[model samples]
Target: MRKALRLTALAGLFMASFAQAATPIDVYRDPNCGCCKSWIKYLEANGFSVNDHVEPNMSALKQRLGVAPRLPPCHTAVIGGKFVEGHVPVAQIRELEKHPELRGIAVPGMPAGSPGMEMGQAAQAYQVIGLTQDGTDEVLASYPASSTQ
Candidate 1:
């Protein structure tokens, strides 16, 4: 009986972790951009399933996707009806997933130390900005860029 309980507990733990996992994101980026590829790899390594779309006309795509000009980045992603722009952290993406009402999230420019943009121990201060369909935005969180201690 004890062994059965232990096995059931283990199974439960495994299922819980799996259920909490983040869903894959479909990313659209410029084919020639190395930074965008790096960001995709970062997402994949951190357990995000990436669907990459390499387009020659990234600007046109961005505009069509309704990603604001002020929040342009190296890449853009859409998942569960939410748009993710720039080098946004996986954790923030997960947070956005929980809030179904949000239109999208953006990091604006590529800040040094943001995931694939890491540069030594120095990190840039950047904001994860949230947006609405009407073009309103608000700061979700301010993340410091840093890859090393």
Candidate 2:
């Protein structure tokens, strides 16, 4: 009985530490949007701990977070002290984690095949934009015609 109890306690400690090791991502989105929920699920599935915030004024939230007014998406997230706007891919998210110098990353506008915006055969080519806190922007990654996700 004592051996079983020790093993159970050890397992609990391992689970707790594993959870703590996950990066925490805070997502803000409109309450009425279904795509936002899908995006949150995508993040969670990719090993991110998500904190969802149902926001009524999305534009205001974007403005305060340093996301350009021109770049708009169904949802926005704050991860690793940087802003992530739109349906950014898991690979790109991992890239940002590896390089914390970037101020933010974004996929402006909703394109089908993206994590939340996906539908059947309607995906469009899009670029993942990297932005500095100063408002300067560049294409960090691009999804071609064949793969929009």
Candidate 3:
């Protein structure tokens, strides 16, 4: 009975730790951007602990982070030292962890119906672009438009 009780306690502890686990991400956004705040709330809901930073000059910040001037940058985020630009979904963000060869991943522009940019089920088709270590862009994931729209 004591051995069984010990096993159960250990299992419970493991599950507890797993449940409390959260990925830490630092988000930099312009103070005037309302959508960025919505994105932060979405991240928190998806088990990410956000370290929010309001930057006055987002252009300089994005440039310093290696984000290309061509990409539509609403906000910039760092996850495990990799840049995540624009409104990237949580699933693709998790996939980024598996590919160390990628310098970072981005959604480019704010697409309607993305996590924070939801517009009553009107989701626009978008692709998650990944910047490789070799400095080439690749499509990592594609989100289709919602049929309900």
* Top TM-score model: 3
Q: Which stretches of candidate 3 lie over 4 Å from their true place?
A: 1-20, 147-149
Candidate 2 has an lDDT of 0.85
Model 3 compared with the native: what TM-score? 0.84
* lDDT (Cα, 0-100) at 85 in candidate 2: 93
Per-residue C-alpha lDDT of model 2 across residues 1-149, encoded as one tens digit per residue: 99999999999999899898877889999999998999998888878899999999999888888888777777899888888999899888878876555688999988887877777775788889888756788788989756424
Candidate 1, residue 135: lDDT: 78
What CA RMSD would you report for each candidate?
Answer: 4.2, 3.0, 3.7
lDDT of 3 at 146: 83
Off by over 4 Å in 1: 1-22, 145-149
Error of 1 at 141 (Å): 0.7
Predicted structure with the largest lDDT when compared to the true one:
3
User: Tens-digit lDDT track for model 3 on 25-136?
Assistant: 9999999998899999999998888999999999898778787776756989998878899989999988888999997889978899887898676689999999888888
* C-alpha lDDT values of all predictions: 0.84, 0.85, 0.87
Candidate number that wins on TM-score, 2 or 3: 3
| Per-prediction TM-score | 0.79, 0.82, 0.84
Clashing pairs in 2: none
Tens digits of per-residue lDDT, candidate 1, 1-149, equal 99999999999999788756846789998878898989999998888878899888878978887888888878899888788999898888889977655789999888888878875767888999988766788888898545455
